[model samples]
Target: MYHLPSSPTIRVLDRFSTLPDEYADDDQLVSFWPLLSAILLRPVSTTKDVVDALEEIAHVLRQSTGPAGDYGTLSKVLNALTFIDFPPGPHPGMTLRLSRSQAACLVAHQFLTSLASPRDRSEYYDFGIWYDSEQPHPRAAEMYITAMCVFFADLPDINILEEYATRDLEMGGGVSYVLASAPARSVGNTPMSPFRVLHNDVHVTGPHSPSSMDPNGALVVAANKVIGFGKSATGEEVTLGTTPEACPAVLVTPVLTGDQVVVITGASPVLRVTGERRNVAWEIPDTRTASADFDAWRMHRAGGPLLLMDALELDEHVSELGQVPDLVPENIEREVHKATTSFMATAATTVYTPLWGCGAFCGDPAVKMCLLWLAASMASVELVLLLDARGQALADELEPFVRRWQEKTAAELRQWLGRVPRTLRGGQVLAYIDT
Candidate 1:
């Protein structure tokens, strides 16, 4: 049985083609819009109805398939939408279906992902912010994508839609980093679990490997321009003039060298933010992280199932303290949007991060705190702003910030969601499989 509710509200829009002309043209979307509108108009909806509509959408896409790349993009869109809420019972019209921003985001997210070859990604770099010309604003793009994600990302409580993201992210593959991680069961156990944050979802923490500390969950870290990788110790320079071979899917994203949002899918690490390739690309062979900055995003890494986010821009010159490079409010907003967005995604159950900019990067922890606090504030995930090597000194430095984060930590806000293993009610299994 489904749990209780907050408040039931419903609204219906009669039109489907309400989106403006600026959105990228997609023949399939053009035809499917009306059907989508009808689905939303239902006086009442069932979980089955939601899946049927998705099937219809996929059916149409299959008919208009362009190439292998097109299929891949379509697949990701489908996958991301795999976990959607139908609001069990008679509630209807609770969707972002008609928003032009959502449509534009759809097009932007899908555009080049299906291309057979790499092309200039500058055109789609920035979405949401309408430009006089086609040139993009990375910051705008990050914000737009994050905003649109709320429409169908993860949600509180259990629903078929919400579970799909969890299923694909942890059990199989979807738009997440688990697929890019090492085998689920490396020590000869059953298959390893997929990367996801199933419970106690919130945000906070210090710099470290994105997936190492709590392999069961997800982490976010900085990257460096230098080609080498480091261990658990993040925010350092580890350039070794080496590069991982690019996977075919890297072409879908418009990544450039030293740009942020390069995701690793259990193998080689490739840039996923800009279209150009770096002379030397960074890779964390053992799942370590490095230094970089951001426009905030989660992009698919080539070769593996993990999607990397090249959010940080690398400060080329190492500083006396460290390369902290220039900081921008937009940069903070972009990354915060990501943390918030990922928090919404089922993949981020327990959000952890470090004192970002305070390392060799030389950024003021105070400035970083404002942005981080904004992210933690907006997120539903459990955030733990860790007191690592800095210890009491750093804690003393940001006493107010620490207190603020603590105040936010309550049972309703954050708690320990211990997983209780399951067993057969009948007792021990003394039988054998016939498979």
Candidate 2:
């Protein structure tokens, strides 16, 4: 019911008109017109002439290519026809008719023949024809399939078509295109800064405790330096410390070593460092010790100070990170949910309702066509969900309807879903969802 532009026919005619007489012979012209017309619009009758003409046009269109070649000329003619004024209605030999505006637009496209080219010969075939071919153009076939389900009133056959379109779109780099544009932050491209550690010593006038720095002896401490900083993938830098003017650092005193581990402790403002590093390492005592007690413990007292840096680097990176772009899966899920809910609601209301009171309803083909689109869109969502176990929840609710429809269509739905026909002894219904 939706009016397609007559440009296809007009362009073909325009191309014919522009051709040299030899190429535009009456036999070829007349033969080409009907064929092109049939290709552009669905044939109204099963007559041999209409069918033969369409077959010939399709053959030629499929093989035509190159500059000013048969394909190029045909494309030009079709483009011109897009702008012609043509009436819409049930035509004598066409399944659908074009409106005046649509026709005129087709005709106008003829003038823009520069847009036509034989190089892309695959664009001519529609879904019905393309699917019937053993070797169809990947892109053209996909578009044709989607167009049939989406633009034509072919709700019953949309499931397979929709899947084919989705798969092709995914393969044609659509998902990667979206992901490549996503934004995120990384820590490999940031600045590093220094930090510090401090130690304190104490002297006790008590008895000589083994002549070494013990809890009752003198204690000596030293200061060590370290730095802390953060970075981002974009090369941005952030420094960590008490003051922006100074590097971040920690101080400790009275380093103790035992059990192959070092321990440092303090009082009031207790500071402990633990761990081992080849060049520089610091350890914190397992037990709390007052600054006074720590000051008294020493034996050739050693002060080890290690820096606390990059601890918050990962955290900073995560905080600065951006969201990823939406991909096909997410997009499809959203559309499917929206469409499915609407269709289910409508089907629930209409399938069992009586038609006696539905009077004076406009039987406009356009309205019917729109309804068909809604049905197909809904069905497409259902079919996709059927391929995954996750859809079981939805499928359970629709099982009754699905079974009924399957029975009515002679299992056409199941066949399209890649299951064997019902007549097959080993035919099995595949689980709709991934386990």
Task: Indicate which candidate wins on lDDT.
Answer: 1
Residue 145 alpha-carbon offset, candidate 2, angstroms = 15
Specify the poorest-scoring 10-residue window by lDDT in model 2.
173-182
Q: Residue by residue across 1-435, what tens digits does model 1's lDDT show?
A: 111111121111223333344322443233234333444455434434533443333333343222222232223333444433445432222222212122222332232121112253322222112211221232322222322333223222223223233333443332312212111111111121111111212221111223223433334444332211221113221110011221222324443232234443322221121111112122113322221211011112112222233334424433334323223333544554544443334344454544554555544454444344444455444454544343444445445334433543222111111111112111111111000
Q: Compared with the true structure, what per-residue lDDT tens digits does model 2 show for residues 101-206?
A: 1211222222112122222232221212232323223333222222222212211122332333343233321111000011111112121111111122211110
At residue 295, candidate 2 shows an lDDT of 19
Clashes of each: 55, 57
User: How does each model score on TM-score?
Assistant: 0.30, 0.19
Evaluated at residue 165, the lDDT of candidate 2 is: 35
lDDT of 2: 0.22
